[model samples]
Target: MTTKVLVAYGTTNGSTARIAETVAEVLDKEGLTAEALPARTVTSVWSYDAVVVGGALYTGRWHRDARRFVRRHREDLAARPVWLFSSGPLDPSASERDIPPVPGVVRAMARLDAQGHITFGGCLQEGARGRVARMILRSGKGGDFRDFARIEDWARTIAADLTADVRAGWL
Candidate 1:
């Protein structure tokens, strides 16, 4: 039987959606069947054998819908394999600095025993923010810092884990 994976994400300016698509592509290349969908559109988690939820961060928080999805489906998610990814931290100039993690989301993810979680740098459009948001973006030294190679590698690892679990009759 083919493994079914859902790559659900929430995006503001579309960077996180692209990242989710790329993750699905990587899983597809590894012979796993995956679908990339928006978090709001997914009504349930029962259909997928594994799930990967991702979203962009705004004001140091994840998209509300994404957080709600995890909270609502926590039990179902805990019963299966799940992974989480966050897209933010666009400070390429300070490569050594660590991006602060969102505590609420992190706590929710922990309940599901999430396979992994990652924070990727994101882009900020010139006029996409108000005065205060723009100042925050500027303070972060903005740039598109998404690393496709790293994203693909991470997806491959997820695929490998699922594959191994299936082979061992664990899934």
Candidate 2:
């Protein structure tokens, strides 16, 4: 049987959406049925075997849509394999310290018992911020910090885990 996966995301400027798309592509390449969709638009995850939820960070919080999706579908998510990710932090070398992706993510994770959590660097668009905020961010040097290689590697790992679980009759 084919494993079905959903990569649902919420974003302010579309970067996180693109990331979710790439993750879905990677999972598809691994032979899993995967689709990337906006969290706000997803009505049900009942048909999927696994889910990946991600969102852009703003003032230490993930977008509201993602939070609500997790809340509304908590039971469904808890019964399946779930992974969580937060996209943000302008510094390329930034790690977990920079993520701190709001209390919402934490609550969602508790509700779902997510298998993993990742905090990835994100790009900052000058137009997305106020003038003063843009000036401060621009001062530190800016560029795309999203690591596609890392994202792909992680997706592949998830696919392997799903396959393994099925083989072991754990799925």
Model 2 has an lDDT value of: 0.84
Q: Give the alpha carbon lDDT tens digit for every residue of 147-166 in model 2.
A: 88888887898899998988
Off by over 4 Å in 2: 95-101, 129-142
Residue pair clashes in candidate 2 = none
Off by over 4 Å in 1: 93-100, 127-140
Q: List TM-scores for all candidates, in order.
A: 0.88, 0.88
Could you list the CA RMSD of all candidates, in the order they appear?
2.4, 2.4
- What residue pairs are clashing in model 1? none
Residues 1-171, candidate 1, lDDT per residue (tens digit)? 889999999887788899999999999999999999999889898989999999888878897768978887888999999998888777652234445458866886779988878777787766655575588667766668887887898899999999999999987
Model 2 TM-score relative to the real fold:
0.88
